[model samples]
Target chain A: MPLDIPLIGARTALWLVAQIHLFLAAFVLGAPIFIVISEWLGLQTRDPRYERLARETMKVVAIAYSLTAVFGVLFAFVLMGPYQLLTNYLFRALYPVWALYGLFILLETVCMYLYWYTWGPLSATTVRKWMHIGIGVVLNVLGTIVMLLMNAVAGFMNTPPKAIETATLWELVNNAAWWPLNLHRFLGNITFGGFVVALFAAFMFLTSRTGEDRKFYDWMGYIGNLIGVGALMTMPLAGYVLAKELFLYDAQLATFMMADKLSGYFVMQGLLVVLLFLGANFYMWLSMQRIEGGPRFAPHMKAVFGVLLAGGVIWVVPQNFFPDLLSKAPPGVSEQALILPERFAFLGLMVAKALAVTAIIIMTFVTYLLYRRARATGRIVWGRIDPMAQYVLIFIPAVAVYLMGLMGAIRSLTRMDYHVYGALKDLTPYWYVVTLGHSSVMAAITTVSFFLLLVFVFWVGFVMGKAHE
Target chain B: MSDPGTDPREARIEAVPLTPGAKGGWRRVKGPGIFALAGLAAIWVLLPMVSDSWGIRFGAPYRVFFSLAVLGSALFFILLNWGPIPAPGSPLTTFASIFLVYGATVGGVMSFGLWYYPQFEIPKPAVEQARAQERGKQAFLSPAANCFACHSIEALGIRGGTRGPDLSAVGAQAEARKSGTPAEDYIRESIVNPAACLTPLPASGLAECLPAADPARTYPPLMPPGFKDRLSDEQINDLVTFLMGLKGLAEQDGKSR
Candidate 1:
């Protein structure tokens, strides 16, 4: 049955809830992987700094775990209510997978609470420390399984096997886009977790009073940024593989995504990604200032900046002025002129854009190498970074959040006018793909809402810690 | 007392003894090496731009070459600068540096957008028709319509799937398919209502026109019957226009074939 809520409508309501749930879920899943790494590093190097960072970040994750669950339940309610038909069909089709997802969630929850609560107790002995790390390893395993289980459903919805009705459960789980989406989301979670951690560290660094606190937070921010940026470098390649798989599954769907309905949305995505690269690079350059011998390579860094800018320009150029390929140039404006000229048409092709993306990634790596070299030559004075660097650190996560929301919208909208793509059509009044402008506004809202809630999560951690103290 | 120009924190700078092996030997060639690499990349980029103006097609190979050259230059620059320099600057200079990179990024994207925007002038009628034909070609190739999949226009170098007869000369063939039928009317009927245009066979006793090609070979009724519902009126019209413009091969080419 067709359904609509009063003011916001069912689709928008579901979008908001799903986006929030996904943001929190990503943090919930992503934080443990890195937190465990930090814990292990502390044990290896016997650095109290790593342990403190891990324990502090775990507090935020512990609090966010509940928020993720609340939103997940709310998301379910939205799906089962207005989107009853779709929910029912999906449940009937893959109840086993859903059950497995549930089981994993329970295991993950138990492991997470244990790992967080036992940090202090477990550090008393090396054997216990390893045991705590073992718990973390189990938690990460459960989280990854949960993510993959969910990806199967999403990937199947986008690209159902040709004989879907009679297809075995194995076939359903191993759809063309399943593994690619799994890899993409896996890398994305790490990147997301890293940036969010960095954002937290930046906030702490900005508000820190004592030099020691500032120094600790500064070091934490650097590690977070490094992990985030390092993971980010591989995301585009993963994304490319995912897109290729989707295209291979259904040429029309891919065309709809890249050349038709969602074309302009990608241009906006390009802008966000450009902001992320520029912001990350800018932070690194500013960070170099804290290194004794960093300033000598300033000119080289400036040249790299130019290359990144040029690549950004290429990546954002649209093949046509209008978002939709079928759209005509406005009256009095020649269509020929609106279209990319023949000589420059090659710039709009995938080859050129791919090359541009490669250049951007390479330049980012170069900047990181320069920073490392500078460090090796002299010493890095922690807590000496410019305040602007902290602001840039904060900016990167905001852009990352926005990018995630936009990409999620694109992925869902690729099934345009259908609930399960070609298998089950959407019969609602709001079946059409929304305009790029509308989607961008929705993504902006999601980004703001996510950050506001994240601030709450951080505050809860802080308040609870104070109470314990 | 610390100098007023310097940060007070600089007074606490930790000194690290540099390894003697990592001294200034590499710095002598680093600057010149990076310069040479950057110059090579610039030349690769400029070559295509200059060659394109002279009507030379560098094609995919040259494009890939230039892309790699740019990447190589960046990599070389990083490798050469693997050493030490000076300290952090004042807050003002740092802020300026941050803004400069961001400002350039924004300005670059906006400038490219503006450069790509069309001039506000109407195209001539021929240009309009050409645009329509282009749109029609896109629709034909589009996955939604997928007309190119079953129909090959060998004259246009399209080797379509072997589900239907070659339509390289459909414009001329359509007019000759039936008596007292206009080419446009027949083609439109064939698309929106495929059943109406089925080829008649003496044995099967159907009542449509003869096959466009060989008398014994008849196309199966495999064309979609819902183009009217699937495509907009303008799209169908554009497809028709694009197909109508496809004349048969030149006399010599036809004879050779």
Candidate 2:
């Protein structure tokens, strides 16, 4: 049966809703990873600071979790009308997993609400607070399971095994690329959740007037940034492994992805990775001002900054080895010359990019080490950093949001007229290749729009807090 | 129950004297903060000047400049906002300033990048077997016309599976498959209207082979039909060229049908 929809294009609508939904989903999935840790830290140390941070984080998570569901339900109905056949097939294969996912969500929600509400009463004693931490552990487990179940469906589409006779439920669950995708998204969600929470901490830091409040947010922001950057540091390796799995599944498909029309996107992804590292480290540099002994380690910033600068530049070099139709040689030069001939042109290759990214990660870890040392040995120099540092805090999340959107766009479009890689082609009238310029513009708009919407969500949370008070 | 907010310890600390360093912290932030704000305002004003730069036929150096401009602006903010000050204004102002700064810098820079960067034009190549082969490779693997999905070309490390038997020798096989079917027509027909052709059995959907009987007859044709309408003539020909170059297994060693 022919499926047709009027007024709105199915692909565009689905893509728009899906991108927004994924961002929310990432937050919901990732927030609990840190929330549980925070709760555990609070329990072990008997520190009210950790306890307060966990409680506060849960408030934001509750709002995001609710919106995630709303968007997820909306996405399902929106796609159901236009992609009936594809939806039915996936539903048939994934109904069991879907049911499990729903069950896990229900459990997670119950645990989250209970964990948040019971904190004051249940934490009257050390034994009771440990119970609360256990509840948090349950909530986190349920959330991770839900994400895993969904990734099974997503992974199946990209790398369906050929042996139909052997395609049992277990085999389907263990699709060629399922584990790699699961690992990637698992780390990705943590990274996303940490950044969003950091975004909140930054917001609070900017608005804080009281010395105590500033100190609280400053520490909270450090923790959030720490978790996020730590997770982010490992993501490149996870992503590379996922890409390798894709290549092993279908060499031709992988080649088309890395070397053809989509080549420029890898260049773009490289740029985002570099930006992420820089943003994380710069925030660290700003953070040092709040510690008295931080200046002694301050001299180390120059070296760290140098590595980041050199590494970032090397990471984004366009390695365009394959004959990409989308990328052209500079005037008066051959395409080969654009990639080669230059002394440092080899940095464009994966090996060089890997080395650069690894070096950046190591240097950033050293920066973290110094921050810890400052906290240990130095006087508490709270409220010492410039007020503009708040803008830097604001800038990090903005760049992160932009990178997320850009990366999503690159991932979705690199499929290039396929709904499920090679299994199902997109046969719509709009199945033409989108120009790199057009794709980047769409990504930028989505990023900006999502950031604006997020601010609204944060504002809504703020209003809710006021109303409760 | 005791109220923590009404604690005597907290009340006593609230009356503690502020050190000179603590007092100066709030005062030092205003100048740099205002300077940064002014710089951002200037950038907002300069945005329009760059927005009208769409038609310029600049080269890579200009692209580099634009990229560096974005990186520089961000670093510029970091430098300007380097020290702490007493939190000024409300959360709303901070929010507004961030959005404003984002729009002026990242948004403006990206907008310029989008406008200035040239879109790729389709390649026009002189008739060469190598070029056709390359085009064919792209089409064969393209998610849009994924010929690699159903056919294995071991030479390319694409194990499309026994779903269509190995297409490694399809180049030699198609030419000799049926009467009145040339290699080109055979490959095109097979893609555009697969059910109408003789599809190999175990590859299609046959579970078990029958003794002394044709296996191709046991299974229904498996390939999705109607590629004629989906793909252009050029894409089809390119795919055909790719398939024809497969030539068979490595063990065949230059043998042709």
How many backbone clashes does every candidate have?
A: 1, 4
For each candidate, the alpha-carbon lDDT, in order, equals 0.75, 0.66
Error of 1 at A301 (Å): 0.4
Q: Write the per-residue lDDT of candidate 1 for residues B54-104, one digit (tens) a residue.
A: 543434323443454455445434433344322224545543443343344
The segments of candidate 2 whose C-alpha lies over 4 angstroms from its true place after superposition are: A1-8, A320-337, B1-87, B90-92, B102-117, B120-257
Candidate 1 wrongly placed segments (more than 4 Å): A463-469, B1-257
**TM-score, chain B only, every model?**
0.44, 0.42
Per DockQ, the best of the predicted structures is 2
- CA lDDT for candidate 2: 0.66
Structural similarity to truth (TM-score) of each candidate: 0.68, 0.71
Candidate number of the best TM-score: 2
Tell me the deviation in Å of residue B211 in model 1.
42
True interface contacts reproduced, per candidate: 0.02, 0.17
